[model samples]
Target: MKDFVSVIITAYNRQKYLGYALNSVLNQTLDKDKFEIVVITNFEFNKPNYKNIIDIYDNQEYLGEKIYKGLHESKGDIICLLDDDDMYREDKLERVTSFFKTFYPIYYHNNFVTIDDKGNEIKIIEEYLKIPPYASFNLPEFTLAIENNRKTDIRNLLKLNVNFNSSSICVRREILENNAQYLRKIKAVIDSFIFYSSLLLEGNILLDPARLTYYRIHTLQTSSGNTKNIKEYKDSFSNLFKKAVEDFYIITEMLNGKINENILEIVNEELLRYKLLYKIFSGNNILIKTKFNIHLLNYYLLSLLPTFLGNLYIKDQYNRTKKVRSFQVKSSNIF
Candidate 1:
């Protein structure tokens, strides 16, 4: 029988935490034969002798490319991605497989807990999600209802009001296969590409309320680390805004007739708002050369305000959407 799930872990210079992540997978409640682990690392290290582990090394340092390679090498009906610094709860795989058998969602994910570098719990995933208390539905039902109600989940996704952690997501292999063309076009933000493309292609997403993964937040992690200067902060936000716009266009073109027109309009409005903010904070000279509009006027007016006030606004917005921990942890022995 073919493997039921493939867990793909992409690691780069995180050997200190990789072993714990691997051990978490090895300790899953599911039978060893039901799932396989594929690790793509950028390190040359001693390899473990686990029979179910497949290791691939890439020296090029492209995260998206490594993920693409992992998908290509995966040989299972379902695919689950994990980051080397994060870990799965022992029953995550077993529960996910069982949920699939029951609801048959094309895409699925569970809530996750946030931890500090030393493995202390910072906050539960629900603290950040915009979902209402006690609101729950099966994946297929939710998707159908959303369409019937003339609402697109894509809006919530773009606003970072929903969870799309690569580590907590499990998708059908066929979804990835069908979207391989667009996936290859991605050089960064691979997780957003997969999530948006799959949903646009009419895949239903199931969100399990159980916190089944531990997402670690530390100084060395890519997204949350290394922003010591104003230039770094501006550059990071600029790149993020650019990628969000790119993904929006890519999905729009790929799912032309399938997406709602109103949804497209809404996304465009949001993009315009982001563009104005990007112009103000990014300090990119090219943005000033573009056609001016009310958004640009608003940006100019905002620029005339006290610098501290503009900075406060930006800081507030960043805190609302960033994946970094909202609270500090003082102690824990969980690791």
Candidate 2:
């Protein structure tokens, strides 16, 4: 198992938690000689004692450039992302390598825990993964069929929650090499795009229930649980919705001209719903209604044909969001 994996850390000015992350990788159960740690960092701290650190720097203007620099510099058969603020359990490498050997999945994971800025333990992510919608749709059967035919299930998979946590995932190098050009094109949240694309295109996925990594949350971080003012919350939701739409379009285009009408209708309908919800939540009637494709308009009209359909939709959306936040709370206790 000599030089079997490459661990890439895209770090900025977060020095407080960097040591724990670096130590986690260095303390892995696998042989120290078997893996290399390539850190793409801008912060100039005393480097760790690890022998294999391949540190590089970027202009710091864009976060993605820092990650791109690291990804290009690293040379390993298997690649894993370890944010400077996150830590991996000692057994993470062992489990990841073992799982990858047996299952040729685009992505593999164990479990992830979140830690607050104060370093309090959070809950595990696996416990929060809502069981996919199954009653109304034969999703498992469809997934299996796609796998059997060696085709990508880009549509159905994206409709489900994003499963890959950047710090918890290990991907094959060939996949990265093949998608390098596409990866560079993405401007925001490159890890999410890469993980989603991999999961959509590659069928074999492994999920071990054991917690193996810690995702840190801090007030300075955009995606943390830090309390925000009304304006901040509005801005955050707006960004989230914009990214969701962008990801949807990207996935839809990637299906090689094979469009699934049912999924298209569902996604378009949901996007419009989300837009309307955002406007209402922000108490801003000035926001224009989202323009949707013909399929979405039909779905909207059909839903509204029944009395109080709009009210019910809003109520259900709130309830579902509550469930997701509840899951997030429960998941925050895992470290």
Clash number by candidate, in order = 0, 7
| Candidate 2: clashing pairs of residues | 122-332, 122-333, 122-334, 123-331, 123-332, 123-333, 123-334
Q: Write the per-residue lDDT of candidate 1 for residues 1-335, one digit (tens) a residue.
A: 23399999888876889988888899899999899889999887566787888889876455567767888887888899898899999999999888788767777767777787778887533331111111122122232212222345555544332334678788888777887776655544555556655665454566666778887866455544224444455566666655545654565565567667766665455445445555555544334333345534665676556667767765654454344454655565466
TM for every model, in the order presented, reads: 0.76, 0.68
lDDT against the true structure, each candidate: 0.64, 0.56
Question: Which portions of model 2 miss their true places by more than 4 Å?
Answer: 1-3, 60-63, 123-164, 199-203, 224-228, 240-335
Please give, for residues 1-335, the per-residue lDDT of candidate 2 as tens digits.
32289998877766777878888898899987778988876768778876788878654734445656777887778888887788998888987777677665666655566566655664333221111111111112221212321344544544433344567667777656666655654444454555545643546655456667776655445442123343454355445444444554554454334434564454454445544433433334333455655634543453434435544544454344333333344333333
RMSD of each: 5.6, 6.9
Candidate 1 lDDT score at position 233: 55
Residue clash pairs of candidate 1: none
RMSD of 1: 5.6
Model 2 score (lDDT): 0.56
- Report the error of model 1 at residue 44, Å: 1.7
Q: Pick the candidate with the highest TM-score.
A: 1
